[model samples]
Target: MRRSPWATLAVLAFAQFIVVLDVTIVNVALPDIQTDLHFSAENLQWVISAYTLLFGGFLLLGGRMADLLGSRRVFVIGLALFGAMSLLAGLATSPGMLIGARAVQGLGGALLSPAALSILTVTFPHGRQRNIAMGVWGGLAGLGGTLGVVAGGLLVDSLDWRWVFFVNVPIVAVITVITPVFVRHVAAARAGDRAFDAAGAALGTTGLLAVVYGVVRAEPAGWSSPEVIGFLAAGVILLAAFVRVEARAKAPLVPLGLFRSRALSTSSIALGLNGAAFLSMFFLTSLYLQQVRGDSALAAGVHFLPMGGAAIAAAVLSTPLIQRFGTQRVQLGGAALGVAGLFLLMTADAHGGYATALLPGLLLFGTGIIGVGVPAQISAVVDVQRHEAGAASGVVTAFYQVGGALGLAIVTTLSLSRTNAAVAEGASHQQSLVDGFHRGLLIAAIVAAVNIAVTLASPQLTPDAELIAEAAAVA
Candidate 1:
């Protein structure tokens, strides 16, 4: 079948939406999932962290697999695996089973996300057509995230939390059936690319996993536990070894040269900051809406509707903005919006109404993030060769996940610490929680502010550049 590029993009974007949607949908269902499955509070966090941890850990390897094997083939495999795991999660009889299923879902997401983005990179020609494709891609990614909460609330209210996972089954099945008819595979153009680097794969995956584990524990372990220190130390050492291995390998899992590209380097670092701010904003605000404002899951999700709309609008607008003012200006503009949004959130109180309080802040935060994010996404993968598109896509995606995870962990800890201090000072629990949330918002504002400086200082991007430089440091 000779499918048009737009049709191919539609398939890819839908798949990407499904993966992104899963990231947040589960948060609303955690209480239900835990109650039904009898998860300990300690283990309940894993329902969310399991997916994020595994997804971040395996993203680099997954991207490499697409490059060496075939993006289309890997895409199908990933979709099927994700669908199967979704079913398993829906049917799980215990916490361990559900958590394990979510872990596999993470693996599937890591594979398909990079594969889909890489396919888009190869399919669309650079400039206007590519810009449109990337815009749609970025828009839907944000849309998926914003809508996940709403959809989760609806599902949990009307049906059951289990339906959240089961809903993916039909969507996956339809996409899987139509994929090969539209998405074509491109062969790697490099010599000796067929050889696999087993050693590199092990080191990279394990190292990333170790670091994510350490960060995840730092919130609970107070960042000073011997186990957390040990894991962080091991992850760093292993990553260092992975770099040496990449430098020496006949076929590096991640080419050392991709990091040489200035556009990718700047876009990637800024994306990490954007990811930290964007993701943590959602987490903290959701807690505020639920705990402080006393809104139900459904109500909290409904409140985000305006933010979702603004985010999509910003994403669509970014393409023109980027084409007009260039990447740096659009990114800075977006970062400014983020800082303003977070700063506004600092004024949010337990008694503050949604219309005058959280709504305006969310609108700005959501709009600003997509404004920053869409351009950074386009910049990250642009100018890379067809052979390395998957790797490039993977690098950008991994940074978002890793950055979001670390940011969430650090800010959650800050919030918790503040909440504890306020309680010791005899404040009401609700007020203490809000105070903690404000502190986290302040830190997030600072992060957004830093992104402006980073954007200002980045090296000029060459139109001919390839791979990612800063990403090599991340890996």
Candidate 2:
């Protein structure tokens, strides 16, 4: 069947929007969930971390599944599974049930993200067409992320916090019913020869989970404690084994050779840093609004609208700017904006006013993120073969999520440590929380500076130049 390329882009972009939205939609609902389910303080972060960990952990495997099976089949199955899990999460009567359901939903999202991207990568086939489509795809991912907090705030306020999960129903239903009909399917590449990498999947998934578990738990349990040390050690060891297995496997889940590309390698590195900066800020800002300033969930979400709004504007503008100036400039400029933003955020205090203190930083960070995200995505896929596009896309996405998890863990740990010291000085709870947030934003600034430096080192590639290469290569 002849497929409409515009329809395909719309479908894939919609899928990405939904997947990214789920990441932050729960943040505004966290306090409500905690109270309703009576969750312990220590485990509340798990509401976020669990989804990220499992999603990041199994992402490579999911991408490989798309390669070995069909993208359409995997996409449909993933959407169905995700929708079911979302329903289960909404209906949960206990904390354990909710967390478990979230984890499963993450797994399904893991499967969906790469397949959607791969479909876009192959379907678009690189040029002005692909560039504009991908820019929109990346933009929507950014937009949905911003919108999640805002939507979560509104939803949690108007109805129950559970509606955050329940709202996926109609969106999922539309995607599931329409996707197969509109989106062209890519058949498995190595249908006969590819055997599932059971051992590799087990090792990689468990290894990442162990590392994330250790890091997330480090804040509550002191880093030197036996449990923290043991988990970190085990995580490192298991991850080492996973790499070894991948190197030796007949049908490796992840092809290490993909890293040989400077574009992909540097891009992924920047992606990790960007993820750290983006996710950690969201975590800290959400807390600052609710815990420190005593804002309601809806109000907190509304406060983030400025940041999100700025980010969307910047992202939409980035494609043309990159076309004119170059990818490297856009990225480096974005990172610089982020650094300034974080520096501004460092001035945030318990008594800090949003207009004078937070708004400027949010705007700068939003603009910078748009600059960084779009070019980094371009670099990640630019040099890859069409056949390897699925795996390449997945690896980048995995790093992005892993970076977020690690960034959150690191920032949260630093926040806790600083909070402890402030508390020792007899600071009030809110004041201590604000102090910790200040310290965390300082760390975020450093990461953004590094990104700016690295992005400056990347090569220039304009959209027309890329399209020229696409034409020549096709001929």
Top lDDT hit: 2
Q: Give the Cα error of residue 433 in candidate 2, in Å.
A: 1.6
Q: Write the per-residue lDDT of candidate 2 for residues 1-475, one digit (tens) a residue.
A: 8889889989878987988899999998888898999986556667887788778878878877887898888888888888999999999989899999998899899888878876876888666777677667766887898889989999998999999999997889899999978898798876577778768878877877777778767777877889988988998898899899889888787789998888778888888889888888888888788888888889998888998888888866876787788778888889999999999988888786889988999999988887797777776776678666556667777788878777777777777679888999999888888888899898888888999777866667665556433422221
Shift of residue 47 alpha carbon in model 2, Å? 1.8
Which residues of candidate 2, in runs, are more than 4 Å off?
A: 1-12, 120-136, 183-186, 323-325, 384-390, 456-475
Instruction: Judge candidate 2 against the unseen true structure and give its global Cα lDDT, from 0 to 1.
Output: 0.81
Residue 253 accuracy (lDDT) in model 1: 64
> Can you list the residue pairs that collide in candidate 2?
none
How many clashing residue pairs, candidate 1?
A: 4
Off by over 4 Å in 1: 1-10, 34-45, 93-95, 117-139, 178-192, 381-390, 460-475
Model 1 lDDT per residue over 1-475, tens place: 5669999999999999999999988776766676789975345556776787678767777777777778898888899999999999999999889989998999999889877867887898766677678667766877798889999889987899899999999999999999988887767536565677778877876787687677667656767999889999999999999899999998776777987877677777888888788767777777678768877778878988888889878866765666667777888889899899899889989997778988788889888998777667666666566556556756776677767766766666677778878999999999998988899899889888988888887643322212222211111
Prediction RMSDs, each to the true structure: 4.4, 3.3
TM-score of each: 0.85, 0.89
Model 1 — which ten-residue stretch has the worst lDDT? Answer: 465-474
**Clashes per model (N, Cα, C within 3 A):** 4, 0
